[model samples]
Target: MPSLNPASRERVLVLLRHARAESWGETDHDRHLADEGRADAGAAGRWLAEQGLVPDHALVSSATRTQETWQSLAEAAGWSLEPQLDDGLYSAGPDTVLDLVRGTSSEARTLVVIGHNPTVAYLAQMLDDGDGDPTAAADMVMGYPTCALTVLTFDGDWSALDLASATVTAFHVGRA
Candidate 1:
C-alpha cells in the first residue's frame, strides 16, 4: 500500500467528454464535434476557469471531435498547450486510459484528458465521491452525455493509481 504523504503524488486528471456533436458521421469513429459541442467546450472552459481548475498538461484523442473539443477549450482559456494526438485514447477503454495517464511524466501535476464515452463515464463513476450531483453527470451510471466532466483526485504517485484508490471530487456539467 502506498502512503498518501507525498506532495508530488497529487497528480490530478480531469477527464471530460467533448461537447455535443451534430453528426454521428458515417461511422462511430469518424464522428465530428457538433456546433453545440463547440459551445459546450467554451462553456466548460469558463466554468473550469471559475473553479480555478487549470490543468498543467492535457492528453487528447486523435479523433476530430476530441481534437476540436480540446482545441476549443484551449482557445477559450487562451492557453497554448501542445496536446499530443494519442491514438491509444481514440479507441481505448477506461483501464487503458488510466494506464496512459499513469505512464505520463511523474513531474507533471494536474492533467486533463479529453476523449469519448462510455470510458469517460465509466472511469468517473468508478472513481467518484459517491455524493456528487448525478445531474452533473446524470448518465454516468448508465451512460455519459456529450460535454460532461468527471474530476478525480488521488493522493499517490500517478504511476501507482488504481481504480479503487482514487477519490472523486466533482462530476460537473453545467455552470456552478
Candidate 2:
C-alpha cells in the first residue's frame, strides 16, 4: 500500500467495474463470467494484490459476470474478504454508484466495487489522474475491455468524498 496519512485511515475507494461480460440472457446474473473474462479477472486481481490494494470489504453487483469476476480475482490474490451482493447495482447510474461506495462501513479502510459499464466507465473518467501508465489506462479511457480494472484512491471515508476527492491511480486488464 502506498503511504497514506493516518488521516487517510478512513478511506474512500472505488474499484473500477470489471471488464467484458456475457449478455444477461445467456447466463443470468449468476453465470456470466466468460472464459476470457475469468482470465482478465485473475490478471486484474494479481495487479491489485501486488500493489497491496486488497480491500477489507467488497460491494459487488448481483450479476453473474460481476460475481464471477470477483471469484476469479479472489482466487488469484488469495483474498477471502467478505463482499456484499447488491441487486441495485446491476444498472445503476454514477450517483448510485457513489452511494454504494459511501455505504461502506467506517472501520473498513478499503472497498472494491464490481459492476457493469457506462457507470463504471464514467466513474473511471471522473476519478482518473493520468499519473498511472498512459498505455495501461488507455483501455479505461477508451473503453473498459472485459475484466479491466481502474484502481482509485481518496483521502477520507466513503461518505466524505465528492466528485473531485478521488483519482485513478492505476488500471489493469489481462493481456489477450
Candidate 3:
C-alpha cells in the first residue's frame, strides 16, 4: 500500500465494476468470475499499481463474482488489506451505495469499492465534479464495461461526500 501523509486532506475513491462472469448460475449472486474475468481483473490491478492507487481500505459486494474479482485484483496488486464484504452492495442502487461510501472511516485515505453493473457506472458518473481529465470523463461517459474502474479525488471527510463532490482523475477498462 502507498504511504499517505496523515495530515493530508485529499482522498481517493476507486469504483470498480465486477469482472465478467458465467451466464448461468443457481442464482445471480452465485455466479463466479469467468476465466477471462480473472485475467482482466489482474490487468486492472496492475494498472492501479502502476498509477500508485493502492487502497487503504476496500468495500466489496458479497456476490460471488464481485468477491472473485476483488480476490484476483488484490492478488495482482499485492494488496494485503482484507476487504469488508457488504451484502448491501450486492443489491444497492447508486444512492444507497453513496450512503455506504459516506459511512467509510475518515482514516482511510484511499478506498476501493467493488460491485456490479449499473450501480457502479451510475455512481462513477454521479460523483464527477466535471473539472478533471476530459478524456477520462469522456471514456467513462461512453461506457462502463466489466472490469472498468474509475479513480476520483476529493477534499474533506467521507461524511461530506455528495453528488459532484469529487473530480474524476482517471478511468480504465481492464483487459488481458
Candidate 4:
C-alpha cells in the first residue's frame, strides 16, 4: 500500500457517494445512474487507480444506483474486485456505516465503501481530523457531490475506528 508517512501504521478507507441517478418514477431503491453519473464514476475510479489506491475490499449498497456506481468504477479502473452488496447500506446512518467499516477483514489493507448520503458525506466529515490536504478538505466541507471520493487514513485497526479516529488524506470530486 502507498503510505503518506512510513513511520506511522495507517489504514486507508475510501468513501464514495453513489453517482447521479434518474428516479424515473421508480422506487428510491430502484433508481439507476444517469449517463453522466456513469461517466463521473468512471473518472473517480481512474483517479483512484492513478493514485495507486486500489481497494482490497469494497462494501456497496444493494440499491440500484449504488450498484451501478460500483460497476462503472470497477470497469473503468480495470479492477478485478467484486463488492459485497449489503441491504444495511441502503439509507444507512453514519453509525451503521461505521459498524460495517469496523467489521472489515484485517487482511484487507485498503477498503472502500460505496453508498448513499448524507451518511457517506457525514461520516467523512466526522472522521476527518482536519490534518490533510486543505483544498480537498474544503471540497468535502462544501458537500459530497455525486461520485465524490474521500480518502482517509487511520492509525489503528478497523475494529478501533470511530469518530475523529482518522484524518482526511485526500478528496476528489469525480468529473461529470
Ranking by lDDT: 3, 4, 1, 2
Clashes of each: 3, 5, 0, 0
lDDT of 2 by residue, 10-118 (tens): 4636465665566556446655766777887888777777777667889898887788888888888889986899999898888888887877787877788888787
Q: Quantify all predictions' global Cα lDDT against the true fold.
A: 0.74, 0.72, 0.92, 0.88
The C-alpha TM-scores of every prediction are 0.83, 0.83, 0.96, 0.93
Per-residue error (Å), model 3, residue 156: 0.7
Q: Write the per-residue lDDT of candidate 1 for residues 1-176, one digit (tens) a residue.
A: 12212245576668898778656588766777777778788888876666566677799988888888888888776677788779889889999998988887777777889988888887777666555444544545655678888666676677888765665556667321
Please provide, for model 3 over 19-138, each residue's C-alpha lDDT reduced to its tens digit, 9 standing for 90 to 100. 999998999999989999999999999988888777888999999999999999999998988999999999999999999999999989899999998999999999999998889899
The digit string of per-residue lDDT tens for model 4 on 1-176 reads 23533134577899999999996736889999999999999999898888777788999999999999999999888898999999999978999999999999877778889999899999999998877777888989898888998999887888999988787878888895
Q: Tell me the TM-score of model 2.
A: 0.83
Looking at model 4, report the run of 10 residues with the lowest lDDT sum: 1-10
Best by TM-score: 3
Q: Which candidate is the best by lDDT?
A: 3
Better of 1 and 4 by lDDT: 4
Residue pairs clashing in model 1 are 21-34, 22-34, 139-143
Clash pairs, model 2 backbone = 19-146, 19-147, 20-146, 20-147, 29-64
Better of 1 and 2 by lDDT: 1
